[model samples]
Target: MRQVIQLRTEQLGATARTTLSARSALAWALIELQRHEEAVAQLRGLLPLVLAAWGEHHEAANGVRLHLGTAHFASGRPARAEELTRVVLAVYPVMDGLRLRAWTLLASALSCLGRHREAADEYTALLNAASPVYGEDDRQLLWVRTDRLHQLAFLAEHDLVEQESRALLAGLADDDPLRAAISGAHAFVLNSAGHHAPAETIVRAALAHHDGADLCLGLARSLNGQGRHEEALRILTDARTRCRQSGDTEHVSLLHTLTARALLGLERLDDAETQARQAVEAARTHHGPTHHRSLEAATTLASVLAARGRHTDAREHLTHCAAAWRRQFGPHHPRTIATDAELAAVPKA
Candidate 1:
């Protein structure tokens, strides 16, 4: 396919350009194939040509911009993706399929940038607009709800996560593919509230239907909470391997964070520190520095440092983490409160 694309590009004359629509289709194909760099480059090169030919607000140009946004988001530039998606939506205010796509991409980008509240609002907008066309039980609406629930979880609004998850699940069939995701999110809510036994049971059942990274992550968290460090480590190792092979960088960061916690539980301080550091870097690279996952990884690293008797380093790290969490989620949010507690627990040098 790469060779075909190259040949097609070479066949074009100086005076003859490929149709922007055809180029857009090729770019989308490249994105699906995970050739993000090529897709981004192709879309970037096509954007000016599209704008010159059809004008900025032309449907064709907006389509290219939308595709470019998707490529940017996939390539770990969520802020740029969000900008492009907003431009697309601004040009088309009506509720159409293309506008819906723009909204989805915008919400996803906001979420990845650690703007969970904005993401939740965007998802709400999407749900409200989509329900009239696709109805309440549409698969797309269900997934949108799932994404909002996840944002609520990140914001430490666990009660809402649980409430919405239950309501969403009640309507989903057992055989629905969306069921696994809903169950996983529900388990995450359970695990976050320190209900490890129930969380473990919920995630284990979800795994029976879909062996996904989110379910594995929830299960690992449950085991780690129970002090079953070895079991958690084993599950994380397998999930991390699969995520690495599939190029699921976000999940790989999540798995690494959990693995570090498991190792810390087992008193493997050095190994835990190494995994924790890697997880922090991965989360920062893929999800940005302010994302909840990045902060969580930093917190795990601080714990490992404290366990190694590097209390000074732990104290400094936890101080930053606590301040960041407080800013992002406020003083009373679970993350801010927990991080403050961890900072207070760190011994002074």
Candidate 2:
């Protein structure tokens, strides 16, 4: 435990569950700090107290379960998260706050479990319930809609994803930053539909409207999709410099992965492997190994390793990506399938 958590536990006494909910406070603090594993440990102990103190049917207990599930999900344990969220949604009385978030998490859990059709259904139900309570443009509603769009894109429903992105863009002004972001989103559909040139154009316009890291990353990727690797490398290198100067470690890590991909395309095998390793380390430090970003970085790195005839390293990386993707994005998702294929292509020792 952290010193503060120990001090508060002492004040609250280890045996008592009180109105202050000191343990819950500690869990919240740990979660905010992104110490999800530690938060999960705290939530495990706190939940029984909340349940014993308030009874299973009480809101406090439901809240405990909800946060616990969220922590589990963050810690890359979606199976446990799905179980807890399902139970909470069954008994939680309210439909707006905890319930709404629970529904969203449930859909995510299903998606992670490789149940996309079911996940989509759950997302649809969540959207239906949330739309009236919170308008279409509400931040929370927008997040769920965005999740649905990614799921659609993953499932190769390119036209449906495009239609949804258009609808989202329709509600915003052309000059609005949100429109830029939405326009950037359409790049996935365009890339998937083999229109990388247009995807590159849209992402560049998004960057012109807002100098956001996401737009830059999208633009870099679209450039890569078109095999304009030299341009992609330049864009990512510039963005990486900015991210490093700004102490934006997340984008720095993401840019490193893209940089490695571009380097591989240019046949710079040694540099590609070095950047790939750095990207994997950075992502692991910031996002944990099970996160999609971390896994994807590792996957890209594996390709670099294989290119250099480092089959052992490549196979190990692919194995990790395969498991992580199945746990985080489902086996049928493009990433997981790609990793599996890579693993198959590796020579046996």
CA RMSD, predictions in order: 4.9, 6.2
Q: Which residue pairs in candidate 1 have backbone atoms (N, alpha carbon, C) closer than 3 angstroms, thus clashing?
A: none
The lDDT for every candidate, in the order shown, is 0.85, 0.78
lDDT of 1 at 31: 95
Q: Where in model 1 is the C-alpha error above 4 Å?
A: 1-18
lDDT tens readout by residue for model 1, 1-349:
5455445545664333456678889999999998988999999988877676566777878889999999989989999999999999888776777888899999999989988889999999899988998898877778889888888888878888888888988966676778788887788767777899999998888787787777888899999999999999889878887787776776877888999999999998888999999999989998998888888999999889989999999999999999989887789887788878888887787
Q: Among all windows of ten consecutive residues in candidate 1, which has the lowest summed lDDT? A: 9-18
Q: Using TM-score as the measure, which candidate wins? A: 1
Clash totals, every prediction: 0, 0
Worst 10 residues of 2 by lDDT: 1-10
How far in Å is the alpha carbon of 256 misplaced in model 1? 1.0
The local distance difference test score of model 2 is 0.78
